[model samples]
Target: MARITTPLTNTEVKQAKARDKEYNLSDGEGLQLRIKPNGSKLWLLNYSRPYTKKRVNLGFGKYPDISLADARKLRAEARTLLAKNIDPMEHRDSISNHQKEKIENTLLNVAKKWFQVKKSAVTPNYAEDIWRSLELHVFPYIGKRPISEITAPIAIKTIAPIAEKGSLETVKRINQRLNEIMNFAVNTGLIHSNPLTGIKAAFEKPKKQNMPTIKPDELPDFMRALSIASIKIVTRYLIEWQLHTIARPSEAAGAKWSEIDFENNLWNIPADRMKKKTSSFRTVN
Candidate 1:
């Protein structure tokens, strides 16, 4: 016949003194209170694997942090796993891994991961703008939610307030970014379909407005002002070049002397430099 271990009380556990050597106070069924020489009390479970029959020690936690009742509950759950022929530590690890994966698949997490890959292709200022928009508009509502849980309605709701504020352009841009993120999730196997696809149609279309520009009649005065203004010579020349060639400010700024075909009276803007690749050259004359 095997000797049975007696159950311990909370009072005995609390008052248990530490000695030169570490010792355990049994609470029956493998749960024990380990008292260390430094007076630290820890909860531990000693159990044998059902398959291999090898003994294992499972840490419940420190005694005060994990109350007696909680330790017993954990021990009972561990025993339940043992009865099912599963290792308790392995089961705990599986549950932890699942939770970690869930956190990693959250809308914000997935969006950030996608942003890391995208930021390299865009300017630093544009990348900062992308994150700023998300932090202000998208993160408050659905960022923490798992990507798989995001629905079309939720996505619409997230941007509806911005649309209602007459920021239709912002709404459109946010929707575009969300579409990219959701598409990334799909490609990565995190989701089956993009919930934000076609979501832009739900918002009001932005009104088109032409950029402010000087009228043809104002050109003489504009040129007079430019020539006399307290501006650098290079800047004045750049302005004159843009006005004559009708080139965008960016194209004019990036123009190299080598691309200027002075012999032919032509500014041969490279295909790569032209906004529309088809338009290759402009007659400077």
Candidate 2:
């Protein structure tokens, strides 16, 4: 049979004095005011572990300071957790640990973690370029800031100077990398949401530009200029080959003698080195 406890009043709690031996004043359902012999009154909850049913005391606060009402409220919350089969102490500790992690996980630290995972998917040179972009444009400003506190306004302000310099391409890449880091923080539980989701809209869009190429009518002048240019013989031949084949700079430079068929007189640019990853061939006429 369960024994009913009478609710304690403010007067009764205030009047409680230390006794020769420690004793508890029960208000109701597991909330108790423990009076020690040395005259300290503490409020705590008498609870049982959900599975093991082992009784444990969870302290709310000292009496009067915590008040009888506050103790009862805390006991109710703890009881709610117990009903859910969750230990209140463990829940409190989990929250405390998460807060500590947020404090320690700075933008630079989280970016580094994201990089470790990202670098595996990209080439070493390309990976270096990605990290270098952040170092030059981002780390100097908010690297030490906690990742959880970064917002779109803060990000725009940080990169506004670069945008002002008319380096729209660089700014665009910075915004992308910053959002990637923020999203990484979210996925890793360092932050609740991404604050830079739509940050790109804050800046002017980059203008559409086309790759400059030499026209057929300009070929004679280009050839004359290239012939007299202060460059090495190999560089001269390389430039001529680049223009003759009409291949992309990467495709031209990455060409090999082995890729050329003497009998066929065809320059075969393999799929790997060619843009769009498609093999291209040009007649050596």
Candidate 3:
């Protein structure tokens, strides 16, 4: 090996390589530039691994940007990391892992997984409706794509079709589901931010809220008309109680005789059967 010395110029480095395809240009202070046949040049720092006789390849920056001067500086930093008992490459890998975890926990990924784990939360009749909307409306378009890749444009496009069908209420529900999924993802360190945040207004228009009750005067006529009309006994009682006590239709049907005390004319709704916002109470009618 030809020995290199300090104060070497760029011309000397290039010329010395003309005679021999493989040569190192000593840039003084333990830094050397190695040139290969393909005209590729790399900077190397001469150093021994900590407590070991073996030499290790620190790294090289892009040519020109990492000039001989800058190359030495990087080598010095790498040496510093080594002195602190850290491996530069290992540190880089750790950073990469952290970034990957952030992406995995993004709202999009969490939304999908939440749907999977909470399928039982929704009724069997409505479960498929929810799944189809997510699969065709959301997943096919953005599923398998990284959570970090979701953007406002993508979100708007994905939801526009559903909104056009006058399913604004459904879209609202979907948005809430996405929000919850993203929250779980955030807790798990899968995503740092939720794209679903502030997404309700993104829908083209606000959803139409269904009227929960009729005018007070309309109740008497409604009850009179239903009592005279021929409807299923269960249906008649359900509509009457729903109107009288403002109970949800689903809850009225799931109510058991055991839970109702006819002697007291009172009904008690348990927490398990109540809707999202309904109060669990012992109602006296």
**Number of the top-ranking candidate, with lDDT as the measure:** 1
Model 1, residue 76: C-alpha shift (Å) = 2.1
Candidate 1 Cα errors over 4 Å, as ranges: 50-53, 98-109, 119-136, 139-151, 186-194, 204-243, 246-285
Candidate 3 lDDT, 17-85, residue by residue in tens: 422476677676556777777666777766666656467655565456676567867877877877887
> Clash number for every model?
0, 0, 2
Against the true structure, candidate 1 has what lDDT?
A: 0.88
Residue 123 alpha-carbon offset, candidate 1, angstroms: 7.1
Writing each residue's lDDT as its tens digit, candidate 2 over 58-140 gives: 88889778988888889989999999999998888899887887678989999999999987765444577899999998999
Full-model lDDT for every candidate: 0.88, 0.87, 0.68
Candidate 1 TM-score over all chains jointly: 0.67
Candidate 3 — what's its lDDT? 0.68
Q: By the lDDT metric, which is better: model 2 or model 3? A: 2
What's model 1's lDDT at 257? 86
**Better candidate number, 1 or 3, judged by lDDT:** 1
Tens-digit per-residue lDDT, 100-202, candidate 1: 8778899999999999998866644467778999999999889999998899999998899999999998998999999999999999998889877888889
Candidate 3 residue spans exceeding 4 A from truth: 1-109, 112-136, 198-201, 207-217, 227-233, 275-279, 282-285
User: How many pairs of residues in model 3 come into backbone collision?
Assistant: 2
